[model samples]
Target: MDAVVKALSARVDAHDAGEKIVHRPTREEAEAAVRTLIAYAGDDPDREGLVETPKRVAKAYRELFGGYEEDAGTVLAKVFEDVEGYGDMVLVRDIPFHSHCEHHMVPFHGSAHIAYFPSKGVVGLSKLARVVDVFARRLQTQETMTQQIADAVEDALQPRGIAVLIEAEHMCMSMRGVRKSGSSTVTTVFTGIFREEPAEQARFFTQVRLGK
Candidate 1:
């Protein structure tokens, strides 16, 4: 059953890989959209102080959502198999990231905790963080981002198990609506051994909360 799940996950990853190659709007078009949004907000986009705001915003958007150009699999392509038979779980925690909410387009900033049990080899420690960043620098929900990170690791490394947990504070909630500040959203995903074994899952959770 585990093998079946991993196989299906790999197929899904392959299908998704092909879907990311869509055309994107030009910078001028993006700037024009920003100007339209500014006008929609009842602000004069052409005003002396606001005239350059659209250009600045367009440039910032490219950096903020740069994940669209990155491929998670490519980032995990280079692996190291000389672990001396170390099969224990590899955990990387407190990886800070900033992402935008898909619905509100507001910012959500926080950290992610990732872990995986290698079967034959392990990926670079920093690549784990890069995978997190690849999905983070896009419009996302915490739930989807958590699963994407786990799936990317599973598909690329075929680990014995994978676990991902993310905790973030969304500006959409803090800066508007209920105005609840300091409130964070936590999402988690577990696969393979992590999903089949409660003890392993518990350990992952405990380790994540230990220093917090």
Candidate 2:
């Protein structure tokens, strides 16, 4: 099941990899594609209000999918060695983010809680939030994004342990399929000590849900 899921995600990530590698489409081409979609959806692309819609959507796509242009490692590259030898678990919770559903191209909005045991030094608190945003700004499945965020942090910091929990409401389920509104999905990834120690996992869960 895990292998199948990974395969599916890889396909989604490489939707147009061939074209992208050869020659990415220009802004005009993107706008034209949007216009084609508008027409296919039974809308008049030439209509005054909709005439400019394609352009707007194309522009929005750049901002919405900008994560593809960023590297999480770069964001986490700088570390602070001045922790005064303070070695402990650091937790950041209630990080709000929104991402497009890779399957339906809709949206899923959520919060991510991250915890890590610093092996050597510590990173800026804001860097963690930035990490969440970096992944959130891309087309994703909650499960895949959860793993990606955990992997990115683990690779960059080489922490003793890392835990990532994400809770989200996928619009694909509510807006289209089952139509079950107000339903949220949660996904988590634990590495190293967090994976080995049940107590640490329990502590993470407790802290994440402490007030909420």
Candidate 3:
């Protein structure tokens, strides 16, 4: 069992290492790109009012895309086996998050609900929220973000089942094409028992919708 765990851990480490950017642009370059976009928008980049806008935008990009520097596996590394033999679904709901739409590079704000059935080990509850944030801080589609959260939890805990649901309002939809204001998008992903058992899936959804 130790060998198996070590092997899995090594694989996860390698995967995370591979995901890192090798030749990323410098801060100055990023600021330059932002200036270019400002100019393209018919603004004077050198004007007094806009002189610092590119630097500010570049700084904001660092925060918005910070997930690229995080590893979900690392956040989920610590697990507790002292659950007192509690073996049932553990759900965390209403975890608010902000992400950029990969398609339009606009903002999307949402809440995520995650649930998992542990076998012998359980992770810290806050780690689940951290997992959500790690994925949420990246450029993503609602559908892809949901699945990524589910997959990250499953990979870390080896849970018997996992389910993830995300509901979000996309600025691209409301401010651009279609202009469907107040409309939200939802995406769900189920794995293991959540995928195999209809009753379990229903229970997960019920728990997720309990107060919302």
Candidate 4:
């Protein structure tokens, strides 16, 4: 619906800054849309068992897609420059996340591995996980999400090198199409030194796969 698209577009930063402001639809509108979906799915929306489903779905969507309301730059704004010149590879691995596949609107859950060689300073270890969560709580493809995470870090930290790897099992494939439940998709993005040096890329992979 136009209302839904407008509401979603209102939350995106890229659509701002010179674009006309589009107001987000009311909760009632969202619920109505959900009811429409139920009817389209051949379910009676007014049935007692399904009467409250629309409301529940609307609430769940707010939490699931809360990433649209967040800014990754704001999360990574505070840089800790007091690392005592300890410039080395900071790797955070096995960060669990669940995202919806943009194409099918089905879930793809996975772990992310992030590494950056700090130049100016370092960020809190937990911030890395938060960054991952920010991007994950949205409709996305694994490849685009992987690069978005890396780009966010690269922009915020200006790291000497950055490496990001994400592996996810898409429900679109497992629950529908091919029905390959255990098959996973891996995507990686490298910048700066990681892009230039194969040894650094190998080290990153080694660190991520260690003990696994």
Candidate 5:
């Protein structure tokens, strides 16, 4: 296993993308590494209690972070031409998500609120969730993730305004660092009219905060 790690590490080093290497080990390699971790932790991975744990974890990852395999534009590409020129803020709230924090590779569970006012056309509500998924799938901080959601919506639709709010609990903080069980992180991003017009932003915020 050490030899395998050495070979893989060499490959990542050779193809290093930047300061924080974005190496994606193959599924087989990832599962093998998980098996090694189970063994290293003094667990008999082949035992009935743990027999399929590695495979399960790997498969779970494929689902949890599947955004990498999808394109955000494809999801939002369909736009409505005839809103009859009815322009108003389109708000989508409580879009559920679970992402891994790049810092600790631990879960950060949350719901997102996305809002945008179309200038010429509008996208469906579900596309808002797809926009969130793209940034969430990769290593992220809440601040950057929030901005990404807003920016993508604006870039896609040339909207009059864009707002994104994220509220999450970081397992890295709750389960390990300081271990504060109830601590929650909230972040927001606003642009265009949402930034210039206070009332518009407030309207979006008020709606997302309801039933929170």
Candidate 6:
């Protein structure tokens, strides 16, 4: 079966009496898994330098992967009631995020550039960063993460256009695959006006990229 199908099936199986599925990983399970990773890395977890590492890593990941415990829809729930009819392009740039690549379970550290044109009501400025965080906390691919973040924001705000860009360095490719330490990966997602209008997308890209 496809990944989506499997995920859906798992969700269905995990439903409660109200038919709602809770998807967040437990703190205990995550900490135990950190121990597993520590062992897999061929290290002694009891050593002084590494003794607190597992617990620290788990605690750190609780914040990093906090998205699994949050509803992105709810995070963006509060839209601006009054913007004084402010309807220009709303762009949030260089929103820092980190996630583990699902394939290798290695860290991918990056920043995202997000932009959207409001249709009617717009979201708060911080909501943009929260939306980005919701996706970046999971084990993911840069490509899918980019698309999912863009889709979630578009769905929540119903924007005229939405665009996202992620620039990350994958430890999997660097620490394992090709072993190139300095190379970074970039991914982008564009929808609505950004998808239909070439100039809009280019302008968005030029704005974020040139500034960097």
> Model 1 shows how many backbone clashes?
0
lDDT for model 1, on a 0 to 1 scale?
Answer: 0.87
Worst 10 residues of 3 by lDDT: 6-15
Backbone clash count, each prediction separately: 0, 0, 0, 0, 0, 0
Candidate 3 residues 142-182, lDDT tens each? 88788788888888889999999899999998999999989
lDDT of the structure predicted as candidate 6: 0.79
TM-score of every model versus the real structure: 0.88, 0.89, 0.89, 0.90, 0.84, 0.79
Tens digits of per-residue lDDT, candidate 6, 1-212, equal 34532353323211124656646455566677888888898997778898777778867865775666566788888888588887778888989888888898788998999999988688888988988787777778888888878777877889888988889999998899789998988888888899999999989988897768
Which candidate should be chosen as best, given lDDT against the real structure?
4
> Tens-digit lDDT track for model 4 on 1-212?
65665556565543235655556676789899999999999999999999999889988988898887788898999999999888878999999999998899989999999999999888898999999989889888898889889989988999999999998899999999889889989999999899999999999999999937
Cα lDDT, all candidates: 0.87, 0.86, 0.85, 0.88, 0.78, 0.79
Off by over 4 Å in 1: 1-21
Q: Spell out the clash pairs found in candidate 2.
A: none
Clashing pairs in 1: none
Q: Give the TM-score of candidate 3.
A: 0.89
Superior candidate under TM-score, 1 versus 4: 4
- For candidate 3, the lDDT comes to 0.85
Model 2, 1-212: lDDT tens per residue? 44532332321243343634323466778899999999999999999999999889978987897777667899999988889888789999999999999888999998999999998678899999998988898888898899889988988889999999999999998999899999999999999999999999999999999949
Error of 3 at 83 (Å): 0.6
How far is each candidate from the true structure, as Cα RMSD in Å? 8.2, 7.3, 7.2, 3.6, 5.3, 6.7
Task: Please give the distance, in angstroms, between residue 165's alpha carbon in candidate 5 and its true position after superposition.
Answer: 0.7
Q: For model 1, how does the per-residue alpha-carbon lDDT over 114-196 read when each residue is reduced to its tens digit?
A: 99999979999999999988998888888889988988898888999999999999999999999999999999888988999
lDDT score for residue 196 of model 4:
99
lDDT of 5 at 197: 95
In model 4, the Cα lDDT at residue 125 comes to 89
In terms of TM-score, the best-performing candidate is: 4
